[model samples]
Target: MTDAITPHPFAFPDAALEDLRDRLSRTRWPDRETVDDWSQGAPLARMQGLIDYWRDAYDWHAAEARLNALDPSTTRIDGLDIHFLHLRSPEPDAVPLVLTHGWPGSVFEFMQAAPLLADPRAHGGDPRDAFHVVIPSLPGFGLTEKPTETGWTPERTAHAWVELMRRLGYDRFVAQGGDWGYAITNELGGIGAPAVQAVHFNMFPVFETMEAVDAQEERALKRLRDFKENESGYQIEQTQSPQTIGYGLNDSPVGLAAWFYEKYEQWTDHGGDPESLLSRDEMLDNITLYWLTATATSSARIYWQSMANWQEREIEVPVGFTLFPRDIHETSERWVKERYPTLVHYNEAPKGGHFAAWEQPESFTEEVRASFRHTRQPL
Candidate 1:
């Protein structure tokens, strides 16, 4: 495969949009949940409303235009066409930074934050905080070429990211991520890539058993336990049998919408309603990308390939972390320090959850600027 970073702008076929609308119109919905709240999964009414809006009001063309505005491109890395958005900062002294999106997420997650980070001065922040931002869709996700073969785990993805960065002329750079983005970033720092001078995570996955020495740690452990017991059914199914579920997710737009809408409801930091924080269009922007790409099964396979093999390992590079309160799992600063000895930065965001960047772009942007302030240098 050629190492060609081709300009791959968004231009979805009209027939694809027609098919999506037709599929939405003909969705075979299931019966309503017995419970009123989200305990049983996305409520039938909630999903119906969403699907109604998706079919009637949502504009895929508008979303397509937004994606194209990010300067989208693709390159063959490891025999796959990896789609990514690359934005060079106007500031000459800007530091190169790569942001990796997680499952149920696309480059759409960073649409707001990427611009803020790349042009801090334009956003009323210091020019010194500017970053040459690169947001890559994970292999088998979004517009990226789906892997036909197995073995594309997070570790392998991390290596591909390093190569992608190197090919982009970033001999030295910083990394930031959350969710599976956190997993991939963790691996990036652990693998001793000299080019990765520092790494940052909004979600630090700490699985090691340690006694809680205080109330905060105790609460964090309780949340972790709760996530494992109640909130991880999707993880179990995806890790064990992604292909089985892929059939439904790929075929039905409603199925795909409900699958991701559940997480937007359960994971975001909002009152009872996720719509209070995230607009319907914003949520659909990401969900529609998944539907258009037909990556439901392929994206799920990442969990199958990576989760069982996860191990606790020290990340030697300097690290930064911003823990959002409403996330699925919480880790005490002590736990973070244990894993990242050279901890350069850590903070608790006032708001946001699993989709931190999307939920609170301003806060997410500020955190990234602060986290890498110490690592910035002329590239």
Candidate 2:
């Protein structure tokens, strides 16, 4: 692959946008679930409301403008074109930091948090907490070129991140993530890359074999069981045959929206409605990204490539973690320290969930700044 990095300003053709609206208008929705609640999936009324707004009122160009403002760029890495948003801080001492987004999310996840982290002074915080943020769209996700061959696991993605940072002139940097981002960031710390000074996670992967030591651990275990039994249908399908499901998601705009919107509804720290925390436009901005790029299948392939052999490795690099209360899983400090021996920071956020950065940008920004504070001394 070439080492050249070039600007990747993007705008969907008017025809594509019109096609998306036509698809939404022609969607043949399934019958409503018998249950009033979301036990089955996204409620029919909710899906209808989301699609109606998306088709009639949502502004794709506005979202596109916001994304363009983040300095999007692309470079060929590991036989694929990787897309990333590099936001440099005004502070000369700002630390270089890479932030990875997980499945069902894109670089849009960090839109609000990136600016706050990059220029803390402008966000009513100390200038010393500034970061030159880098947000990369994972292989086969977002604008990144979809891989034709297999083996693009989180471990491989972690190494590609080091190369991406190197090309950006950052020999050493910190990293942070949630969901698959956690897996990738964890690999970054474990790969023995001296350039990866530290890592942080909003989601902690707890092994199924670990025994609960206390009330908190017990509750966490229960939640894990619930997730595996009930909330993992999508995981199982995506891991087993992503292509089979991809045909539907890629064909129907409403299908793609419902698939992602269910996660936002179930994962965010909202009451009964996801819009309580995330605006309709905000959620659509991410879901729309998947639709426009036609990455639903390519993104799911990450699960097919990695989930079967997933295992945690001990990370010696200094580590930090912020477990949001409403997240799918929460691990105790004891469990985290066992894997991250040099654990430097740990906090239990009062609110937020799996999509912490997207749902609670201010809190996510503060947590990131605090997590890497100790690692900022001359890299």
TM-score of each: 0.97, 0.98
In model 1, what is the error at residue 97, expressed in angstroms? 0.5
- Quote model 1's TM-score: 0.97
- Alpha-carbon local distance difference test for all models: 0.88, 0.91
Model 2 TM: 0.98
List candidate 2 segments past 4 Å from native.
Answer: none
Off by over 4 Å in 1: none
Worst 10 residues of 2 by lDDT: 370-379
lDDT of 2 at 208: 83
- Name the candidate that leads on lDDT: 2
lDDT by residue for model 2 (1-379), tens:
5789999976899999999999889988889999989999999999999999999999999999999998899999989999999999999999999999998899989999999999999989999999999999999999999999988988889999999999999999999999999999988888755788898999998768988889999988988988898888999999999999999999888888989889987788997788888999999999889998999999999889999997766788889999998898878999888777899999999999999999899999999989999777655
